[model samples]
Target: MISALTIENYRGFKNFSMNKVKRINLIVGGNNIGKTSVLEAIMLIISKGDPQTIWKIISGRGEIVNYVGIPQGVIQPEISVRHLFHGHEVKLGSAFKISAIMTQANKSIDVDFKIIEAKQVDQILYASLPSEGMDTFGPKIALSITRSDKKNPLLLSIPLSSQGTLKQNTLQTLVNINFQQFPNEDERAVFQYIPTTSLTGQELISMWNAVALTAEEKRVVEALQSLDDNIEQVAAISSPVIFPQFGQKTGFIVKMRDLEKPVPIGSLGEGTWRMLVLAIALVKSKDAILLIDEIDIGLHFRALSSMWEMIVAASNRLNVQVFATTHNNDCIKSLAMLKESEISIQRIESFDGPAIYYSADEIRVAATRNIEVR
Candidate 1:
């Protein structure tokens, strides 16, 4: 688990730090105080500065800039990648960094990220391609990761065309440092980020496919059982021709004791669907990291306690480290009530100073006493 984290010039934070991290971290803060950005930084580090992650963050914020008429005139997006920085400016020498210290027993790995202008990025991304046709060589950002031996760091190429950048696919192509492909046993890590208000049946199905029939699937079913004990089974089906009646929306199916034939998961309430995706994500992220945004999106206040209870047990059982965000007071209070020794709350007030952490007791106090932690 991460023991400490630092973010510099990412999103709305000029410099932010979260120390003494625990197994389950609940991040709360005032609106626009960069609460979600901290989760993004953590996910990026865990992925070792993955290009898909970069695009996910930008796309989630509606920062992708689509082109108008020019098909191949070699033009970069009008909005530069600098928007991720402190002043929203990205000169040739400008860069932002995210680093974390992961600790287990007596061993630890230090993960770091440096986001800088493409020109400033070193030749770490294999032999440099000819810079001739590069899109005016503007201020495109390149992300590099260095957990150890910065001399041989992994470099990434943002997916946006060097010749011309459109809004779509702003960041892509993560090279080197895929821990799964490396020879070292200590470097491998599993990480997944589930964005807010974007959970879909198809996406949940795909995640389920990654680790189905294993102990993870059983944990998922048990997690959903928190919502209803009658939820005997859940399934993900693809290309249902004979069941063409399922049509294109035929992705998730759930079996309740009352139902004769299995019905589409959509027949359930939003809380069920939300819990389904959350549980799947949590289970598949076993012994790894799971970052969730707006974790309390579609659940009733009364259900938050039970939902968190199941989640906390699953997290402990599977050794998954979670960093999730929610703005609701009931969510916060319920979360505090559900906390074991594994949880802590980080309240992001602003970037003017470092992040402030609240103990589980403190959170409960704030909730019961009607105090404003945000």
Candidate 2:
């Protein structure tokens, strides 16, 4: 797991550092404070010098406009990371700096690259640190989903670059992107980034039914199906669907639940989709870093507490490290309900021009008194 992540001269942040990531890390701050940029930095660093892949993961579309904000037309953003294993400390450094000189008409940016590993450079096979029982892939797995904008929205069945191009090869799963071509309007993409196993609410219910519950996994499935409000009950249905694969073109026909047979994903009630995605991600994201932004987007106040319980359990079972951002105080309160074993919470705030990260204990200290470090 990453012990610390450092960023310099990247989107909204001249310099930022986040350390001691536990099972669940929550970033709380105002907009444009680089919360998402921190996540983007992880994805870029893990891409290991592949600008194309980095661009796709960060911006969805491979566009230069996303990089326009960087001071100086410099490309290849710089990032550094520290990883800890057992008793050993491994420090990885990079200077993928860019040289851009502004001019009257236009400006130019040149990308430069530098890297250092703990021991010998040549001995390292991948760019990221290696962990036991897990493939580091030279960097960490950063799953990011940005909300949609009015002009350039994402579409359903959006083509994965790897699905067609030679250079397009990635081990990530993005689902439920919707694009529509209206007769009057010039094709609008409704939703931005929604990651879930099923596309529709009906499909979601079907998936819930399809889950071949083991004696242990059954407890989780039962808890999810027996929700109080909106979701009267969850019933599984049979369906032939294409399951997600990391690097291969392998898919399976599985059973799923129909959460929308009663209503559309747009109407099935808020947080329904978000909760479903969280459940599925927790189950599927074994040994991977799952990034969830604005986790409390939808759902009633009561649902928030239950959702946290489910999330905490899933992370522990799957051994997945989760990074999430939220501004909801209620969501934080819900997390406080968890037992020590259920979830480990790390509170981080962007203040005083930089990010201040704290462990659960440290956060308690700051909260006990009127300690506004900002």
Candidate 3:
């Protein structure tokens, strides 16, 4: 678990540090106060500066722009890196660094991102260039990623198109290479990120398949039962219809105790789907880290306590560290009920100021005193 997190020159933060981070930390703040950016920073560090993760973070925010390919007419999407920095503009020496101190190891993991001008010494970094234009690979700009645990830094030359953006294909190739080198999933830590909109049907099906026949599946079913006691079993199945637009081509269906026929999980309501997704994600993230944005979404206020209860129980059993953001006071107060779980509340004032962290005792005091933690 990360005991402390420090961000420098990252999105919306010039220099920020938050200490006393517990196993389950809830981040609260006003709109555009960089609540989600904190999650992104943690994702980057946990990924060990993987280019694929960087592409996902930037592209998810619609920061990509279209450019004509090397073969001339074909269009390709390029991820803009400027938005990732503090000033939202990329200069010759722009950089950002994120570091965290692990409580178990008592050591820090660091991920640094820097923009440097490409030189002759950087020619060896052009291993994943486009096939057609191998000779014209003289890029003026390059993004250098350095990790504390890694001996050598990853240098990716930025293509000279629309403010020197990174090509999606380039990052994908790097990701493939990384996967080939590290093929086994158990060799690395599991990292799962749930967004405000929750997991899509395809994502949910894939996650369910990961824990389908294992003991984790039972936990998922129990989580759903918290919302609806009638939920007896859950399974992911392929739809008879071929097209997804017409209907869900593949999704989860639930067997109810009262009903004879299996019903689509979506038919039950958004709360059930949300609970199912959360449970599956938690199970899949055993012995790892789970980052959730807007965790209180798609659920009634009545179910907030149950949701936190399930989260606390699963995270404790699985040894998973969870960092979630929320604006709901009920969701914040619910943490006080789970006394056994190590909880922390991080409140962000603004980009110009530091974040305030409250310990488990402080959280209980705030809840008892009816203080506005949000």
Candidate 4:
């Protein structure tokens, strides 16, 4: 588990630190206070500065610029690296670093991202460039991951276009090459990030397939039962080829205790789907980390406590560390019902300001006093 985390020159933060990180840490703050950025930073660190993950973070926010008049076969989206820095301007040496102290190892893990000249990278990486005679002498984005136990850092870089932005296809080619060269880079830990809207139909199908017929699948069913006790079994069925549109949108069907036939998971409501996503994510991230943004999106206030309980129990049993953000008061108060040692809350006021951390006891007191932490 992370005992503490520090973010410097990343997204909305110039310099920020959160202490007393526990097994399950809930982040609370006002809108646009960089709550979600914190999750992205953690994801970057866990992924060891993966280029594809970086692009996902940028494109997820609609930060990419679409270009027209490009050749028919060429990718047209471009992502600016400047938006990732604190000042939103990328100059030589401009960099951001995310570091955390692991309680179990009593050591720190750091991932540094910086802008550098393209010439500094190996020429072999440029072989996949387009044949349109695009210049490869411009600046590039470089990433380096350092661990306390390792002697050398793991390095990766992607070239930038003459416009000083990352082209979609260029990045994809570089990522493909690097994956083949270093296939086991992500063997360290399993990291899963659940966005605000939750997982999609295909995403849920993939996750369900990973744990099907295993003990983890049982946990997922139990989580669904929290929303509806009659939920007996859950399965991901193939989308019908003849009438794909008529099939379950999420490709999941549930067998109810009293019902004669299986019902589409979408028929159960948003809460059921949200619970399923959370449960599958927790199980899939066993012995690793799970990050969720706007965790209370679709559930009723009455179910928030049960949701937290399930999260706490599954995280403890699976040895997974969870960091979730929420603005719901019911979600904040729900933590008070859990053991104080197992949870913590971090509150942010602004991007460049200090973070206020509350331990489990402090959270319990705040809940008892009806204080507004969110």
Candidate 5:
């Protein structure tokens, strides 16, 4: 799991840091407070220096520049991650290059790069850099695209801001999965990002059907049902992946035990669909990092606490590290309830300038005082 992350000069954030992270990290902030930017920074770091991968991370979800085009000044988007790579503690940071020539603005942004040894295990993390003086902090070579007969560049490319180098196909597949595994046909056509290794068609159905409905699932479902008396019982579907039927306008599928039939998931209610998505995401994201933006979306305030209980269980059971963002006070309260030795909460708050993080205890205090740091 990544214990810490830092990002600089990316979108709304000048600098952001999260430290002392646990298995499950929750980010809470108001709109435009750079909550999603943190996730984008992580995706960029993991993708290495691939141009296409960088574009995917920055362009989607309205992160890209608008009609005015790319920003003129320095584009020093940097990200750092502290995690166990191959069971050894390591820190990785990546920076991208931006030129002054993009606009008439005096963007004398000479890139710098360097590498150095660190003193702490998960702290004081830095990336390995080339020998070139200050310009070795990231990849020495900046990527750019040029037409066959043109002398100048056609597109200025910002390389992947990941820790180390990764294969193009490997990085693409990872990005595809990060966005979502259940992209519709049209979504796939634009950017499929799906790996051939991922389960498909009947394979997905078979896997869901074969799931034993373990004790953990039972516990989770019971907790979910407790939130709503209307819910009779929640059961896993054994046939056909339960997903949004795009053309039908239903956001999910529900298999009711009474009728013993599949029904439109939207008819059930938003809370049910949210729980089901979390459940499926937990199961599918084993041994991987799951990034959830605005996790409180479409969730009922009363059910927020129960949803977090299941989230904690999923993280523990699946070896998955969850990084979710929320602006809801109830959501933060639910996270505060999770204070075991194994589970922890890290609250990221953005102030006037840099973003700071608080541990589980600090967050509790802040929440108690009715502070609005985000």
Candidate 6:
């Protein structure tokens, strides 16, 4: 687990630091304060600048720069990776730094890289991006994502100009991440970001397929039961007539004691699918970090306490750390009622102010006293 996180010269933040993090941390604040950017930083640090996340963040902002080869080839970064820089400016000597320390040991990771102009690109060493009316390599940008435990670490350098130059062999996962503490770690610490709204039928089905393959299905069912006790069994169903894709992903079906036959998951209500997706995500995120944005968006106020209960229980059971954001008072008040897991309520101020931290007891007091932590 990470005890502290430090980010410098990243998007929307010239310098930022947040300490006193715990097993389950909930970030609360006003809008446009870079809450989602913090999660993106954590993802980049843990994944060691994986290109998938780079595309996700950029495409999430309506900027598409990924290219594919003739027939179903590896996805490569285009000229758009420069969007990662602060203010979308890719000037030389401008860089970003992200570091985190382990909570139980002295192990830590420091990742620092800068943007530099690449005038020449050799096909053997790096890929070349071709652009119109340019020099030999079409004004390429070369940057390497390198990390280590003070030893010889892994380095992945890619060119930002060429289309078909990048392949699967050019990029890789982080090596000896977290000071080599997890040299053999099964999964990366970072997971995909679950949006605030409920997942679509296909999205939930995809995640459900991942969870169904593991022993965590029972845990997911237990989590859904927290929201509604009538949930008996949850299953995935697919047919040529019912699904658009042929068995690639399946929709959900649930068995209720009152209902004679299995019914479609959507019939149970929006909250059912919302809570179900959260549980499935938790199960598939073992020994890793889960980033959820606006976690309390779709669930009703009455289910807030129960939702927190399931979240903490599953986090402890799976040894997963959670970082979520919200601006709901009921969500904050219900957070204080959780007894199974430790909580850290952080208040992020706008304009690069220091983050305010609050303990569980302090949060309970704030809720009872009607104090505004936000």
Best by lDDT: 3
lDDT on C-alpha atoms for all candidate structures:
0.68, 0.42, 0.80, 0.79, 0.47, 0.69
> Predictions ranked by lDDT, top down?
3, 4, 6, 1, 5, 2
1-374: candidate 4 lDDT, tens digit per residue: 78888899998899999888889999999999999999998888777677777888998888886653356754467787678888787766778899888888898888888776556344456665763434545444343334333655646666654444777777767767666533553363358888997877777676675679998888888888878899999988776332346643468889999999999898999889899889988888888999999999899998888899889998999999999999998899988877748788999987766679888888999999998888
Candidate 3: residue 76 Cα off by (Å): 3.0
Question: Residue-wise lDDT of candidate 3 within 201-252, one digit each (tens)?
Answer: 7777766766888988887888888888999999987653333574432387
TM-score on alpha carbons, each prediction:
0.80, 0.52, 0.90, 0.89, 0.56, 0.82
Candidate 6, 1-374: lDDT as tens digits = 78888888777887788888898898888898888888887887777665555555665655554454433453544335555667776655557777888776857787775655654433333422232212354445555556754574534445444321222223332221223433332354356577665455666665666688566787778777877788888987764244545342237888887889988777777778778878888876777888888898768998988888888888898888899999899999899877634788888885365678998888888988999987
| Candidate 2 ranges beyond 4 A from true positions | 47-53, 61-220, 229-267, 341-354, 362-374
Question: Candidate 4's error at 105, in angstroms?
Answer: 1.6
Model 4 TM-score (2 dp): 0.89
Model 2 worst lDDT run, 10 consecutive residues? 78-87
Candidate 5 local lDDT, residue 200: 28
As for candidate 5, its clashing pairs are 45-161, 45-162, 49-160, 113-134, 113-135, 113-136, 113-137, 114-136, 114-137
- lDDT, residue 66, model 6: 44
Residue 171 C-alpha lDDT in model 1: 26
Q: Report each candidate's C-alpha RMSD, comma-separated, in the order given.
A: 5.0, 17.4, 3.1, 3.0, 15.1, 5.0
Winner on TM-score between 1 and 6 is 6
Q: Write the per-residue lDDT of candidate 2 for residues 1-374, one digit (tens) a residue.
A: 44456554444444456654567766677655656555555554433223333434434323222121223443332111111011122223323322222222333222223223323332232232222122333432221212122453211111111111111112221211111222211121111122212234433443343244644345444444534333433333344543443311112221225343443333344455566556755554555566776777766778887887777777787676677777676676666555543233443354224456655655545445544422
- Which stretches of model 3 miss by more than 4 angstroms? 67-75, 121-128, 131-139, 153-162, 175-189, 238-250
Model 5, clash count?
A: 9
